[model samples]
Target: MESWLYILCICLILGAAIGFMAGLLGIGGGLIAVPALLHILPQVGVSAEKIPHVAIATSLAAIILTSLSSARAHHKRANIPWPLFKSMLPGFVLGALCSGYISEMIAAKSLQQIFAVFVILMAAQMAFPFKAQSNRDMPSAAHLFIAATVIAVIAALMGIGGGVLLVPFLTWCGLQMRFAVGFSAATGLLIALFGSIGYTLAGWDAAGLPDWTLGYIYLPALVGIVSTSMLMAPIGAKAATTLPTAKLKKIFALFLTLVGLKLVFA
Candidate 1:
């Protein structure tokens, strides 16, 4: 088979697996794809050094579609917190827009290394769940706004869809685990939409990038991953509704730790 065909098949499989994990964990599939693409993308003609940026940008673009599908599926079950969504959207948009410019100035590997550390911390958070000790009420609008801004910045910098920060922050703010996961998934859609556009626009001046590469966006990987993830995300979301996410989240965190370590070394 042609190398391109092999790349497509791998992307499809990775998309499905990542989508399932995203649905189960309330994260954008980018957490998985970013590291995988750091390796896979270089084999398909992208520069080794540029692979991290491409992987992150492509993963973010793919998450826009995956999060939309996952959020819509979960929304039907009355899981989303619409008020929180309203409070966070503005900050999310602003954070996402700023991330692109930030990416241009900072080294891509630096961002990846930082993300590796963040993911390690998040893994520990998921496993131990420190928020379990907090005696807090539902977050206020101001708290949510502040948290949303911070999450948006991190999400944009890491190229995640926002749930990585949103879920934990919501939990710390006193939301139940299930509700936090569901609501964060919904918020991630908006974050990814704005962030993806911003990153693409901001990276337009990057040198030696491929054709059809708008900013840092890799069109081929984006299309392949989104196509499969959109089809599979609903299935994963449905499973989440029926299964135990806490246990799955712990397992997922372990997987994240492994991937995060690889990103650091890559």
Candidate 2:
């Protein structure tokens, strides 16, 4: 009982940080949540073979709330571009819906390794920001669909909200930074919603899951994370408008690099 309480406390604290970062950076909180849960879930009795699955699924579940809160805050600021969001919604839904089935086929170790590589690459992208030589208009509908689908598939596999990829893609397509971030936040909600559902359905009959699980989603972690993340997201959204985030991004990039390397070698 005492240990459970301790774990819940840690989850709450982690959720607060994840929420804040999600709102501040428009990242859906999965990047942090996946790594944190990987450490936390094993302490609660999740089996080694299922650890990555639970961590990723639970992170996506948590992101459903975190991203919604962040999206609402960004919406209030009028940052989201509605037409683009609408245009990409179908593809996001389709790709995320398929991700769980795809993940179920992969070995847990392979999934972890894949996530580690993704994290390292994302860290590099964040550490050295990309700049497009010339701003261009949105691509054709088919192009948008392909891009959104691919991004959603990757994001779902990694338990991310897709902002890490989406924001950069949007900016490269001539959207302003603020708008791109906001748009990414909105799209993250869709990804998380469908992605979590897919995971839940896929793992419904799986063995060795810990108690209080909804398929692969761990209830305690999800509840604890959402509880604090929802509250902190608005605060983070407020901070984003005032903070100088370039330095912060670099610091976060370094943190991600370390986490990725640790996962790779562990």
Candidate 3:
């Protein structure tokens, strides 16, 4: 009981940080949550082989609330491109729903390595920001569907909201950055929702999951994380306007780089 309490405390703190950084840096909490959970789950009786699966599933579950909040904010601000979002919604749902089953077939170590590579790439993108040139027109509906499907699949696999991939893709297709961000946030909610469901279904009959689990989602950790993350996100957003965000992003990028390397070599 005491150990459980200690783990919950750590999760709360981790969630607070994830929320703040997400707001401040405009990054997904999963990047941090996945790695942290990889460490925390073992202490809660999660087997070594199942650690990555649980971590990714739990992170995706935790994202639902945060992404909803973000999407609502963007909608209120008229940031989201409703037509575009609507057009791609089906594809996003389909792809995210497929990712859970796909991941179940892959080895845990391979997933960790894939996540590590993703983290390293994200860190590099942060440290050296890339401005997408808006040179092309929006593609046809079929093309949009295909693109959205691909993005959703990758995002689900990585336990992320798909902003890193979506924003750039939108911008490259002549959408403004603000609209791209808003659209990405809106789509992230769908990814989280459907992805969580997919993961839950995929792990339902799996062996060796710890107690208090809804399939792969760890209830205690999810509760602890969502409790603080929701409250802290607004505060962090408020801070972003006043903070030296460029410098902070660089520092955070370095931190991500280290975390990625640790995962790769661990």
Q: How close is candidate 1 to the true structure, as a TM-score?
A: 0.83
Quantify all predictions' global Cα lDDT against the true fold: 0.76, 0.87, 0.91
Q: Write the per-residue lDDT of candidate 1 for residues 1-266, one digit (tens) a residue.
A: 75556677888888888777766665657777887777787666776556667777888888776677667767898788777777777788888877777776767678778879888877887787665424588767777677778888788778787775677677777777777778877777777778788888877787756665778887777777877776776678789988999898888889889978877887
Model 3 / residue 16 / CA error / Å: 0.9
Model 2 clash number: 0
* lDDT digits (tens) for residues 132-251 of candidate 2: 534788898889999999999999989988988888788888889889989998999999999999999988998988678898898888888989988887798899999987788889
Ranking of predictions according to TM-score: 3, 2, 1
TM-score, predicted candidate 3 vs. hidden true structure: 0.96
lDDT of 2 at 204: 93
Error of 3 at 50 (Å): 1.1
lDDT per residue as tens, model 3, 1-266: 75567678889999999989988887899999999999998998888878898999889999999999889989999999999966798899999999889899989999999999999999999989888968688999999999999999999999998999999899999999999989999999999899999999998988888788898888888988999988888889899999999999999999999999999999
- TM-score winner between 1 and 3, please give it: 3
Q: For model 1, what is the alpha-carbon lDDT of residue 105?
A: 70
lDDT of 2 at 76: 100
| Higher-TM-score candidate of 1 and 2 | 2
Best-matching candidate per lDDT: 3
C-alpha lDDT (0 to 100) for residue 217 of candidate 3 = 87
